[model samples]
Target: MLGERILLGPGPSLVPPEVTAAMAAPMVGHMDPDLFPVLEETARLLRQVFQTANELTLAVSGTGTAGMEATLLHMVKPGERLVVCSAGFFADRLIEIGGRIGAEVVRVEAAWGRPIDPADLERALGRLGGGRTTVAAVHVETSTGVLHPIADLARVAHAHDAAILVDAVASLGGADLPTDAWDLDACYSGSQKCLSAPPGMAPVTVHTRTRGRFRPATFYLDLEGLWTYWGAPHGYHHTVPVSLVYAMREALRLVAAEGLPARVERHRRMTRALWAGLEAMGLELLVPEPHRSPTITTVRIPAGADDAKVRTRLLREYSIEIAGGLGPLRGQIWRIGLMGYSCQPKWVLALLGALEAVLTAEGVRLPKGDAARAAAARL
Candidate 1:
């Protein structure tokens, strides 16, 4: 049997027992009367977490990418302009998906480990001259652990008369992103990240202004169609995973009980401790402090340390799971996530101590016995 593992990767953060127990409740038919209220309550909780008053809020039945494709498919028409702020792996995904949908995709790129500058985005949109254009950005670039300024970018897009869509797959409940306050036309996130739920549902909110702009090319991901089923009449659109909805509802309740402000602070505090621990062990972080993500942290592999070996040892010996970098950053850095229920001081200190030991065993030089102490001091 596989051992119980600590999930400290980019996603699928440690699911709390309450969420799992909620999922274990007996399943109900998708169209059953009992399920409608549950769906309604879930959408209400999603709005609380998303900090949006948009009526078009619901959970898609697929993962985070499903939510991404839904917003793009609905908002961008063929030959329309889609401006994507490219910096890391997930941002490139926006560019790729836009192109595949036959949109004229443009990129406002920044260095991988750096946040996109709103001024750069402003200039790019200025040149586009805005006609049915959409600006897309990743709120938290999971691959690089950088948090872009979504509100500022949204303002820039609006200034150019363009609609803005945000991929908050890695931010959502873990970080502060006020959907309505930011004026994002659409925003979507994954259940597995900061929501402390399993990997199926993708919570999405579409501003009223974004509705009816264009008919989505696909039926399943159509935002308005999904909303119709989740709202007033509660008509059937598709067979959503009833159990997963249960899990999402419970997880969202947990988010509400802890309160978003406290939860965000906890994530920040834990990240600071982790940063202190890693730095004390003579490690370098990828993203600069100002732009770093509260939930995910990317650390540079020491010159002599093997990225694959270190991660493997972490999993096999310590029963902890963190991830390596993607795309051009492969073998260059480690991605450590402290999200949702996993964002605890104990886990932060535990990973620091375990990582220090593994690096030492790998013959990597470090200030012996300093990592955990530094992290504890901050905690």
Candidate 2:
């Protein structure tokens, strides 16, 4: 039942065979000498994928949420000011974590389907009187499929001497993100997304300014300690997930082989095809052009179409997996992810054709067979 369906959902996207094979390659003790090279190469490849040269770039032993907590744990100390752009569900996670950390939270929000306005972010930072602050933003908000302007927001934050953190859980490998070039202080992305790996590990990259202190309030989620275990001295922070590390290492290697620029273009090309097909079927995208995430697309469910029913049909009949929107967008937007190995012509065409039949059956009328035709035309 596990491998009976295609992964076209928000993520953990389709894991390529190469990555899966690597994860099953072999197992060794965490402290074994042979594992050191695996750890080293994993760090190097993670840096390449993260697009940073920082020595501290390494994978956390948990999901993206663990990465988020580890990030905010050391940086956003009690009583400090932190600003998060809440455009969708994941951005609210920053607000929640910041509140938990006793940080003064200033939230700048936008309509769900729109990218966060850099002007609004700037204005919010200006309220801080140039005090050192941290700005948190989702690189691609999965709930709404809006790609926020990370570089511009980073520039604004830097001008005011503030740090910038990004949650790239949905857009890491599927889109273009140059961490060092964009002056992003710290960011974390999940292995499940564009990396085309399993969901346990979170690759985190930290620049010098936000390297954080040794042994923060928490022991398990300490960033620097994690780096130490993954880096020099090789001290054990926690029992590492060896298989997940191996898979992620191979995933990054695949990304490096494909080249980041070409990989991003591939995702974009596939996104264009999917969008064209969906639109041709008279389905509107929740996020408008130029701001839509290349990795995941949010399509409006047609009037009178039951969102859960359509998704169930897709999974039950076609064995294709996609997700519904989270938070306020639930039952309104069908999230179709074209990411990693899933961002291919065949998958796109299959999803479109099956979606056509399912929607037609659900009484949501559309031009018969037009979805596949439109998608092929784009390809």
Candidate 3:
């Protein structure tokens, strides 16, 4: 059962054997002399994968949610204003975390399955009367499979003298988001999504401009402390997960070897083929083609289909896995991920065939094997 899964769900993408094997090697001390070099190399590779020259790039313990909390709590202190442009579930998550941290949270929301518009953000700040502020947004909303343009949004945030923070949990590594080139102040992403690693580590990058500006609210997630441990002085902040580090390093190596542009292109190519197959089955996409995300695709559940039944059949009958929608979109759409190692022709074709069979089994009438033929034509 070494490679038994077809992990086509929204997250925790299929982990390649290389990454898992790296984790299986002998575990080492967090601060051991021999291990420091591995840590340094990991940091270097992280910067490359993140597409940022920011000096604060490093992986935080826990999942992507931890990355979101650490970033907001660290940058937006108590009593500060955090303007969140919410489009889907993860965007709303930023608001929740910001409010819990004692920041004055203001929301500028878009309908689900759409990207956050920059004009709305400008209006939100204009109403806030614009001082030193923060604008938080989700770069690619995994819940809705929509991609937001970070560079334009960052421009508006800077115009209002605000630091722009983006949640790239679903977009990073698979999508083309140049953190430094786009002028993002900070961004965080999950290891399980596009990185094809385990679900514990969250990689985040911070700008050098905020180097000495503020201290982290939480001690364990303090950016300065984490940097000190990952970098110079090599001080011990806490016990780092050496095995996950190995897995993350191998994953990043895969990202590098495939080349960033080509990796993103592969994800996009698979997305197009998936869309062609789904559309040929008379299924509609939750989001429009222009705003669709390359990493995850959200499909509307047809009139005669039962979401749970279709998904269960896919799992039980085909041994394939896909996710149901989240938050407001729950039970309305199915989230299918084409990410990292899982984005390939074989996986795409397999899911299409499985979906066709399951939808028919669930009594949703459609031509048999149409999806597979359409997908083959595109692929």
Candidate 4:
């Protein structure tokens, strides 16, 4: 028996109704003229969402990781030095991918639950001594729910003459990321996270400078090849995922209709409400308030409380699903994602209500009704 449960994890967050409906629409041939317009519209909308006027904005037929691979494969060649900021899992993944591409990977490390400091990044770049250092960072670290200072990082990278790539898998639509304004060269995001769409398409944008410098080292994941195929002559690189493109187009349209600024504000409001409710329940947040991501919040479970038990009860009894921590934080943190449509006030209140009951029943001490009341007060 399938049960209806609220998706409150890092991703694949709740899909908007329109996106789902669009995906259900009839699929068309990848090279059909009618479908070409849809592809073009998708690229245009992605450029708008990414806040870039780049000529090569497009979607890849894979998940966010494919976008990451594509960016590294094209931008960083063998024997070049690539500097990566490691604050969490995604950053580590970037370093790994860079290593696989035969780039000399240098890491600027930060503690698991902390954001990478701009000074540290500068120091790392200084140690690398300039030439061939491609700086990479995770804009929003989903593993720890920490928001890195991308603008400052970009400034530091630019000073060293390094092109910066951002993995915005969790931040793209939910947070304010102005690619051009921030001077980010290349960035990739997933459809399932803040886009409120299914998880097949990876939306990516590359600056003109990056595009001009990039060389295709791999055929399938080559950004330059994909760009040329999608642009101008529109030569075929690969058969595009038709339904996923439809979903992305619809999702981007919803984002356009809502306006990026207003959508970001809504996410902020819902996140604040979740934070307030968790605070009222006496749960401690993993990251400091200044570094928290608006899309996801990681709360530290109280000492001696069973994390698995609490999460299981929330799922089985209340039909609500939150997440446990990753890596070193596995059993210590509860990740509550207020992403896209799931970032609604109703979901926040409902999650808090369910969590309160579960924790209270688990023999944790907290005043009854405080969490829901605190969340409501925020609303």
Top candidate by TM-score: 1
* Model 4: pairs clashing at backbone N, Cα or C within 3 Å: none
Q: Which ranges of candidate 1 are over 4 A from the true structure?
A: none
Kindly provide the TM-score of model 4 when superposed on the true structure, using C-alpha atoms: 0.97
Error of 4 at 372 (Å): 1.4
- The top-ranked prediction according to lDDT is 1
Candidate 4 to native Cα RMSD, angstroms: 1.3
- In angstroms, the error of model 2 at 339 is 0.8
- How high is each candidate's TM-score? 0.99, 0.98, 0.97, 0.97
* Global Cα lDDT for candidate 1: 0.93
Give one digit per residue, the lDDT tens place, for model 3 in 90-180.
8888999999988889898889998888999888888886456889999889999999878889999998889999999998899998999
Model 1: lDDT of residue 286: 93
Candidate 3 wrongly placed segments (more than 4 Å): 1-3
Distance from true location, Cα of 136 in model 4, Å: 0.3
At residue 98, give the lDDT of candidate 3: 91
